[model samples]
Each structure stands twice: as structure tokens, then as C-alpha cells.
Target: MGIHQMQSDLRAFARERDWEQFHSVKNLVMALSGEAGELSALLQWVEPGQIGAWIARPANREAASDEIADVLAYLLQVADGLDIDLEEAFTAKLAKNAAKYPVEKSRGVSTKYTELG
Candidate 1:
């Protein structure tokens, strides 16, 4: 399902439990941060260049996916609480990033756009 549909499903699930009262934007953001940290923890012990292979293991992959889902769910809840359309914001942000980091100059560089010159 699309992200919007997933958001609706999550919202319905929350409503069914009267969980909305606990899902304020601040709380959701804090939850999102915690989930992100969980995801990061899964990779904390892996060597930088070997993280891809580490995450490729089936068990690790599932664990990582669960953490990622938690992060997304909390992010979606925060968006709903704030009345923000994530898809629209994502597209707009991508466009802004594209303008700031044109391919010709950014193709092989990790430097910020402000430092490109």
C-alpha cells in the first residue's frame, strides 16, 4: 500500500485504541527519534564498510526493518498530528535539494552545496 494508505491504517489503529491522546507531535517525534536510535544501534558494532553485508543477513535485515517501520510509523503519526502531507513535503524537499546540489558539481563530492565553490 501507498504511504498515505498506511497512514490511514495506522490512524485507524490508533483511533481504535484511543491512542491519539498520547500521540502529540512532540511525543511522536520523540518516539521517532528513539526508533531511529534503535535502527542505528543495530549497526553500531559493524565496521563502517561492512555494514551492508551485516544488514544483508536475514535476521539482521528483519530486525532493521522492524526498527525502520517503527520510525516510519511515528513519523507518519507526527505528520498526521501536524496536518502535514509527507509525500508533498518530500517532493518539495527533493526539488529544493536538487537545486542546491546540481549533479554536475555534486556527482562525486560529499561536501555541502555551500562549500562546492
Candidate 2:
């Protein structure tokens, strides 16, 4: 489903479970951070080149996928609770990043935008 639909479904789920009261922006942000840590843990010890194989393992893949969903769900809830349009925010951020790191200066570089010529 699209992000908007997923957000609606999540809201409905929360309402049905009487969880809306507990889903404040602060709590959601904390939950999102924990989920992000879970996702990062899946790749913690693997060499960069072996990350694909690590994720390809069924159990690891399942855990990673669930963590990813958790992260997205919390993020959507946060945006919805704050009345933010995630797509618009993403688009705007992309535009800003594009300006900060133009193609010629950023291509083949691993430097941050501020460090790029």
C-alpha cells in the first residue's frame, strides 16, 4: 500500500486498540529510534561486502524487514500526528540536497555536502 494508505490503516488500528492516547509524537519518535537501532544491529558485524548475504539469510531478513516496517510505521505516525505530508517533506528535502550537492561536485565523492567543492 501507499504511505498514505498505510498511515490510515495504522491510525485505524490504533483507534481500534485504543492506542491513540499512547502514540504521542515524543513516544513515536523514541519508538522510531529504537526500531532504527534494531535495523542497524542487523548489519553491525558484517563486512560491507557481505551485507547482502547477511540480509539474504531467512531469519535475518525477516528480522530486518520487521524492523524496517516498525521504523516506517512510527515515522508515518509521527508525521500524521504532526500534520506533516511526508511526500512533500521528502520532495522538499531532496530539492534542498540537490542544491547543496550538485552533480559535478558530488559525483564519485563520499564527502558531506558541506565538505564538497
Candidate 3:
């Protein structure tokens, strides 16, 4: 499904459980960070190539997926609470990044934007 549809479904699920009362933007943001940390923990000490294999394992994959879902759920909840359109925000951020990392300066490089030009 599309992102908007996924967001709508998540919002409905939260409302069904009366979770909106505890899903303030601040709380959601903190929860999102915690979930991301869990996802990161799975990659700890894993080589880049091995990461794919680890994530491919059923149990590992499920854990990673759940962590990612948690992050997305909280992010969507925060966006909903703040009335922010994720698609619009993403597009705007992409535009900003494109300007900050023009291909001529950033191509084949992984340096920060400040180091580019």
C-alpha cells in the first residue's frame, strides 16, 4: 500500500486502542529513536556483507522489521499529531538535500555537505 494509506491505517489502529492520548509528538519522537536504536543493535559488529545475511534470517528479519515498523508507526503518529504531510516534508527535504549535495560536487563521494563545497 501507499505511504498515505499505511499512515491512515496506523492512525486508525491507534485510535481503536485509544492510544492517541499517549501519542504526543514528543513521546512519539522519543519512541522512534528507541526503535531505531533497536534496529541498529542488530547490526552491531556485523560486517557490511554479513548484514544482508543477518537480516535475511527469518528471526532476525522479523526483529528488524518490527523495529522498523515501530519507528515508522511513531513517526507517522507524530506527523499526524503535528498535522504534517510526510510526503510534502520528504519532497521538501529531498530538494534541500539536492541543493546541498549537487552531483558535480558529491558524485562518488560520501562526505558531508560541508566538505563538498
Q: How would you encode candidate 2's per-residue C-alpha lDDT over 71-108 as one tens digit per residue?
A: 99999999999999999999999999999999999998
**C-alpha local distance difference test of each model:** 0.92, 0.93, 0.87
What ranges in model 1 sit over 4 Å off? Answer: none
Backbone clashes in each candidate structure, one number apiece? 0, 0, 0
Lowest summed lDDT across 10 adjacent residues in model 3 is found at 72-81
Alpha-carbon shift of residue 109 in model 2 (angstroms): 0.9
lDDT of 3 by residue, 1-117 (tens): 877788899889888999878887888898888988988887788899898788788999898888888888788777877889999999999999999999999999999999886
Q: Between the candidate structures 2 and 3, which one is better when assessed by TM-score? A: 2
Best of the candidates, lDDT: 2
Q: Candidate 3: how large is its RMSD?
A: 1.4
Order of models, best TM-score first? 2, 1, 3
List the candidates ranked by lDDT, beginning with the highest.
2, 1, 3
Where does model 2 exceed 4 Å of error? none
Give residue 19's error in model 3 in angstroms. 1.6
